[model samples]
Target: MSSNIQIHDIVITEQLSDRSYRNRNADLEKQAFQQLAKQSSYGAQAILNALCDLTLSLCDADSSGVSLLQVVDGEDGFTWNAMAGSMASYVGGRAPRHHSPCGYCLERGAAQLYSYPERFFEWMRLVGKPIVEGMVIPLYGKDKNAIGTIWMISHRDGHQFDRYDLQIISIFANHASAALRMQELY
Candidate 1:
């Protein structure tokens, strides 16, 4: 199937609510996985980009990004590898594994929501960016080890992330983890 066709299917599936949405989202996610599994290296990257876009769209957020953690010569850090939406300034940047919010999630090996200013003050101060509602979910490898984080940022005027948001994001993060591992192996 073409990328456009896949995206159209995803968009349509996302319009449903309640159990229907969950069911459709799972189906669409499965389709996405199948597509990724068959892709070449370049195609895999395209799918990863599309997945990032789909994640931001589904979350109804202004920005979304992914960070891959690496243990560098005894130090650790994450590098933003793929991203979509309005927070272009932070994309392609690198952060120390000890200092970043993404790092915090990686260390804890869990999903973290930062909807309050205090939760991400250090990130905002270090990057000189504004604090907004956002979340970070750990991206685990096939070994189930925390290897990265998938994150999204809401605009100042956008609705804050709720429990449902966290749940959906966690699902997307699972997909992201698999994709990142694929990229590493291929």
Candidate 2:
């Protein structure tokens, strides 16, 4: 064979564009929420587990956690019910009801997003640990009282959450608030 090389021109066509990909993902997310909405709350524990799983799935977060604070009669502060997380290790024990970002969110009655790593330094200072990024959405009951919050931490190297993620998680938080209220009532 002759010692010669031939090069062929190549043309790349963009078929599945960004818009189509986003639409597909949105459709899938909607379907997932619909399924979660159908799950019946057989018991309190079952309901909490379902809500945690749904919130985690909807937000596409690596770990999902719920921290509930209830005002105890005659107490100067609130009490933490269950501080649960998808990663059991992260929730080794109960979280304090004060001096934490999640508590700040509860007190402020607003959803807060911590995109920068340094924002968690205070928490690190307290626990001697570090968190990469997180989002916290306050849960409110039908009375609109700030009762609890849903916290999510992203996986290492995962993309930081955006507005869309916040919106989706807000919806999940709304449902979670209702569930928490129902549990408290009955």
Best by TM-score: 1
1-186: candidate 2 lDDT, tens digit per residue: 112311111100121122122222667667756654655366444554566676566656666666666445543333333333446354423444564556656766777666433343333334333445567788776668776677776655644555666667787667656665676742
Model 2, TM vs. native: 0.67
Per-residue error at 63 for model 1, in Å? Answer: 1.1
lDDT against the true structure, each candidate: 0.62, 0.55
Tell me which residue pairs clash in candidate 2.
none
TM-score between model 1 and native:
0.69
The number of clashing residue pairs in each candidate reads: 0, 0
Off by over 4 Å in 2: 1-26, 70-86, 90-92, 116-130, 184-186
Per-residue lDDT of model 1, residues 74-183, tens digit only: 76788777788876566667777775668767666666666543333344555444546667777788778776777877767646655566676677667655666667
The CA lDDT at 15 in model 2 is 15
